[model samples]
Target: MQQIDIDNHHLNFQLELQYARARQRQRRRNIILIVFAIMSIFYVFIQPNQYGNKQNQIQYSQTNGTNGAINITETNSTLLQIQKHFEILEKLLISQFQGKWTDTQLTSNELAEANFYKTSYQNRFQIQLHLKLIEGQFLEDYYNQFSFYLNSSQLVLPLEDNNFVFENVRGSYRRSSVYENDQSSLEIFANLTMRLNNINMDSDTQDDIGIELDVRYTLDSETFSFNCNLNIINIDSKAIIYSTIVSVLGVIQFISCLKLMKDFINENRMASQFSLIIFVFLMIYDGYLGIVHFFLALQSEYFLTPAFLELVLFFFLELKLAKHIWQERFINLQDNLNLRRELYRFHLKFYLLAIVVVLLLYYLIYYNVFLIAMNLYLLPQIIHVAYKGQYVEFDKIFVFGLLSTRLFIPIYYRGCPYNILHAQVSYLTVTIIILLFAAQVVLYYYQCKIGPRFFLPKWLRPKSHEYFIEQPIDGECAICISQLTEMPTESQLDNKFIAKIISQNQNKLMETPCGHHFHSICLTKWMNVKLNCPTCRSVLPPLI
Candidate 1:
């Protein structure tokens, strides 16, 4: 009965140990699953907010005259409208000056009598016109003064000269010498120039000349030109702030990456170290571009052209770096040199393709399209990498954080016009990222709890049970396979074991170049004979 009880007790102990291990494994798995679920939910709910925020930003940019808001189609439409109005005004001016008047047109007598010019020198007309007849009121400032010289008659009549006058006009104008030599043309030009110039000379003079009729009958019939001058001061201010903030953040990220790389190097984690180097280079490049853009923005209101190009480069570099980091952190753990090389080449090709796409979009579609596409592409890649369990290193987490921060910039810029929409979206996306990071931290803590094993601290390994055995082998060492004739006493065994094997164990045990163990005497002889491990034939360490 006592023997049966002992056997049962042993069986129960084994079962308890097994149960504990199973429980530990289950707990670890459950924690991982929970963290993954949280992250998935966060991404699913937050992604819509990202898209909505971007869309709101686009709408705001368009409505508020921001650089990226207006689409190429809309901008082209505006340009066409201005061009059409300009063409109409050009036609009207030609008809009025040439005196080609139908019932719908004004005759040369009517035009001259309307004071379209200040004076007429022979055929040369010096028109100082306060003609309010211009159709497009948006072009009033440009058409405020006029000077017409007839090149056909070699006549020079300087009617009015101002900074914004005809002297600044670089383009060709029709010249007529007949007007200068002919009395009818001279009288007509003089009458037109005087009438146009007299209207705004004085209020009293305008009233005496019946200004309302002159303005209505003469000036009102003339066409007006349109010119658009977009003020970029506000955009410039915002861009400076944006670029500065991004650059500072980029620099901080780069520094953090460098520190992480140093840590990897210290741990002899070559793969992570290499991956971090790529990220560091990319971040430095981005920082440089940001600084350059900040300076450029100060000089020109529309610096986004060059800034967008930099952004394209940044996107490509960021993608390549991210892929390399992910691969280093999670995949291909066999130290597969070929796989690493292939991944590098693949990412290089991908970056090249991304660059081409960005350029094509900028040239063919719209400049702002590059920014949108970059964020869109990056967000997916980040989420995909995260979902794949690809981020083992903290550097990768930091990189993802920086990438996530980029989403906020467009949101802030969009807030200028669609404040409510951007605010809600920003709040949602931020909340999701925060929750996801928190879940990750919890998962990491649990992982550490489950297994505290680390790559370092060789001395901290559990001492082998064989080391405490009282009986020493009387025959040849199991590893050396040499004959032993003399047997030492227990005290001698203890002294030799402690002194020759343990204290001087570093020299007695040969560690191969690959870090596998071997008896030194046997390994040295084997290396001399074969230059490889006796057991595995892996390259042996060099003799001292």
Candidate 2:
């Protein structure tokens, strides 16, 4: 094809086009920022503030004249609230966790002495219990001689970061073991599990974080002790394996997405389907995983690297891949306004459905049901292939990566009893889960092979479209023939023929499915407005 004669075309047209596009992009960015700001304001105002009490923390600054701290009462008030909450927590824990834990039994002689002391003088009863508590794996805090800590769990200090925060609730209870030692006290241990809901494999109910504390206190001093020696159910060694798998998977995905993007960029004719449905699902998937990893990075021993990598991967995957596809495939399609809107709606609707509905159902329902929800992300891609009735080449690593990425959790959760994340599954449950995911993969395979409408009724099938793109042809464009064949301008002549050699060649051509050829540029413009052969009026097909 002949080169486009830059001299004949007004430079202003190119500059104006560039300027218009820049304006459009700027307008879009502004709208996005505005919407984001509004949403952020709404979230800030509407959402309950977890750090409200923290924000109310009292600051002591000296007054110039008096050389005394101002508003000392504010500091007192906060401290009082915290202390009250701690007292309440101590009481509640003591009630649930008695002094003589089932695991630690007193000798017959000791029990007799304790009972006798309780009958004679109730005050000595608590002192004996505190001694026993200390003997039974509880240790006095090195810094504070009066306070003690459980060997099993770390001390839960209010200032330290933790998953759950203890807050003040009204109406405290002073009930205790009725023994004495009012001067003694025990306090919060941080790395404690309250066992919100008993997680049983057979049970359909989900797990929750509950406050299961064993507290004991006298009238003067509240004593709170964690169940240390009883059962230290720390998360398993399998977590390291899980984190390792995640790291590997994240790296693979990162490389895969980068390679696919590179390939697509090199092959400028990007006429294959890039399913927004799958793309958005992946973004959501990565987003949630990234968030989970973020927390893990802070807390877990093995998760830091994977968590950081996953977060980086998600941003990279979404920002680069989504932007490229959006810019090249959607934004560049100048004439397909309705199709663009429809695709946008499709993308948005699925986004809402995936996040709100799928997540809600997954949480509300049984994991067995929701486990399949993870695998169902591919259904939209299937729909796209079906609607188009054309087998578009999809990224194999990406398709399989979805499967591999989801595999580790289900397998470890269901199969390994030692797994900290989830449970021991029945063979049937495992089979069902594997089959559900495998079914999606298999169905996708068939969709690619036998066409997406293999299972559909013949009447519902989309009409076959042959674009003759398999064999792109060559010739001059009829629609733009006058412009192409017009007399060469002085500027055009001056630019190319300076070497005194004829350099202009025929224009690049494209072919219709009906075997008619036209300039590639001209046909692209013509097809945008009218999907028909220019000479024979044969129907044209949609381009990806």
Which one is best on TM-score? 2
Query: What is the Cα-based TM-score of model 1?
Result: 0.30
lDDT of 2 by residue, 411-459 (tens): 5555553344323233444566677667777787777655556779978
lDDT of each: 0.35, 0.45
- True lDDT of residue 476, candidate 1: 46
Show the lowest summed lDDT stretch of 10 residues, model 2: 110-119
Candidate 1 lDDT over residue span 1-544, tens digit each: 9999999999899799979986896686567546644544444344332221222321111121112221234455554443332222122221112111112343121111112322344433332332211211221111122233311111113222110111111111122221122112111121121112122321211221221121111233453232211111223444456556655555545555555445444653333323343353344445445445534543333443334434433543353455545565544244557666776876686567556654563364222333344344233323332232222323344445444444444445322322211111123333444455455444443322332223225475443222112323334433455532232222232223223333343324445555345444444334332344555555432332
How does candidate 2 fare on TM-score? 0.46
- When summed lDDT is taken over every stretch of 10 residues in candidate 1, the lowest stretch is 162-171
List where candidate 1 sits over 4 angstroms from the true fold.
1-243, 259-344, 347-351, 364-373, 381-401, 408-544
lDDT of 1: 0.35
RMSD of each: 26.4, 18.2
lDDT score for residue 537 of model 1:
50
